[model samples]
Target: MISVSSISEFVYCPVKAFLNQTQKDNIQTREMIHGKLVREIRRGYEEITKQNMWSIKENIELEYIFSTIFEEVTPFIKKVSKKYSDKYEMDYSVLKDICNDLEDDLKLESQFLSLKVKKILNTTSKRGNEIAEMFFPQSLLEFPLKNEELNLRGKIDKIEVVNGVYYPVEVKTGMPPSKGVWLADALQIAAYVVLMDYELNKEVLVGFVDYIKICERRPVVVNSILHNKLFGVLDDMLTMFEKQEIPEFKLNKNKCEKCEYMDICEYYG
Candidate 1:
């Protein structure tokens, strides 16, 4: 079964998808290296901050939220700190120092997280859309979705439920545009929309791209054109995988410049 992420890599560059999927050995790309850092920085953001979302909606003070989070998540953080320390071969003291910095910063970070959630429910012109009242989509996190017929499967970042209607939401730690999301990024959310339509039994017309860093949730217009593009990519991937055939390289200098496989890519042209 192909994941939404695998499909995303394909969209970035077919060879990137090919190398990642077909290679048996570990090929650490720039993305894989940085992905760890991103995950480490967000250690307690979603898992812990999400627990306080209700209080945030109730107009709870930021100070109160900050204190409550440390009180509640200390034990969890300690356990995680142990694992992270062992993996990185660092002393527990080193991990604790990093955690302290996170503690100092989370006061402001928590507010950004809450603001992103609010912008989603309360429509804004961030994405050039207009509305009076909030859409109030119930935030569903780490939801698993699969479409067997389409051979599509992945764990979704979030599924926003609005008036019993569901929409796929893909959150990013990276910076976002003042408008629409990137094509590769949009395609990932579009895949989730497809899975939500079939697996969740919800007719979702559109979805969102929650740029967590900037606290902006850009709406993704998932129409037939975008949906067809997603399927077309998937079909190509299926054929490549089934026939054990590697796809031809599409040389776009900008993409290859930052690719993890740049040094090792034999098809560089």
Candidate 2:
């Protein structure tokens, strides 16, 4: 299966993708390790709850959300409660666990919102000094996507719903561009939109790249051009899979230096 991750590697260098699949695991770099840790933090953030400010009208107090949380969570509990019905009070415990999970998630979300506000205040744009608010009103974590016909598959880190529009949100433990997103990152988000569109039968127009460490939210708009690129890359990916031949190495010393496969690749110099 062609992973969304491979698109970025191919963007960086086709040889890197070839090496990534053909070779065994190499030592993870500091950046790689830090990235893994950051992902862990994000994954920990999985649950229901938010310190949402922008979405709700000012007249509504934040306490209203908390008061209604149980009402909102009840349907979910009832839907899944059968699994625990056999045990004594286990179903009740499950409900309690769910509530606790939501509460914890709310705390993390509060922190995240605070950080976002802080960042926006610190930034000054050409238009003038202004603060920005970027948040997901509703989000589903670790969502899976697959297109069997295309032989493509990957898990989306998040699917954020704002108003009624749905978009994928990918968290990166790396640097983001001053303008737009990295090619690989764009491809990944595009793939998510494609898979989601197929599965849901709804058009997914945009997605986000969350550079978590820097607290930057970069939006990626999926267009015909990117879709064409995705198709081209999928073809290339399949071709490489069929041939089982490592593609020619692009002579970029800096790229090689950063690649995990450098130690084992035949052309590394």
Candidate 3:
């Protein structure tokens, strides 16, 4: 299925996009492994946050709320640590120590959340709580789109209402506000909005690229000109996919050097 990630590859390079679409197996590297770890960690945090929100709605005490959630997540942490240890060839003792360290860090984060809850209660007035509750009410919004010809099917992260305006949000585990952010990320969100509008039959005015690592939210406002450009690229990609032709690599020396498929790429010379 074509994911928002496949859209990102198209922006990075059409040759890479073609390879990703057609290649049976793609190489993995240490960087990709580390990136996957970070993504998993961030996903865990998001899940905990969502559960915490639910607990708060249930009127559970903040201290117990955090403690309970942490307890439930410990097994998951241990499972991930064990998997990481098995995947990497490292000293067994060292791996055990690292796992212990990570466990402590998770505990510290739990304590921090407990403190945050107390602070929120102390600082927020009754009136403020009411306003905040209305603004931040729990909602699950998803945009599912499928294009059989393109072999694409995936759910966009969120379609939320903020201040009565619908916004599409795409989450990422990356640095904040790079120049490539707009050029690459905007297209994916634009595609999501387009698909969503088609499905819902309503126009969405704004979208966001949410960088979790840096806590940055980049706004993306899609207009006709930008949408047209994105559509053109998608058309080219679909054409290449249909023909089963590998596009010629436009050597991006810097990116190619870091790419996992560098060794196999015909243009490496």
Overall lDDT per candidate, in order of appearance: 0.67, 0.64, 0.64
What candidate 3 gets wrong by more than 4 Å, as runs, is 1-3, 24-36, 53-75, 83-119, 125-143, 148-152, 161-165, 178-180, 246-249
TM-score leader = 1
The C-alpha TM-scores of every prediction are 0.70, 0.65, 0.69
Instruction: Please give, for residues 1-269, the per-residue lDDT of candidate 1 as tens digits.
Output: 77787787887787777777766257754455445544555545555544544334333444554554445555555566677666656556756776675555555665554455445545533321111113334677778888888777887877766677777888676667667898888889889888877877777778888775665788888899998999898999999888877787658998888777788788775
RMSD of 3: 5.1
Better of 2 and 3 by TM-score: 3
Total colliding residue pairs, candidate 1:
0
Worst ten in a row by lDDT for model 3: 126-135
* lDDT of candidate 2 over 37-127, digit per residue (tens): 3454445433322322323332323345334322333344343344333432344664456445544554555555545444443453311
How would you encode candidate 3's per-residue C-alpha lDDT over 1-269 as one tens digit per residue? 55555677777776666666567255554545555555565557546554544445333466775775476566776676577668865456765665565557667766765566556656664332443344344434455776665555557776777565677788776565564365778888888777767666658867888776555678888899768977787777777777877566567888787665566667677
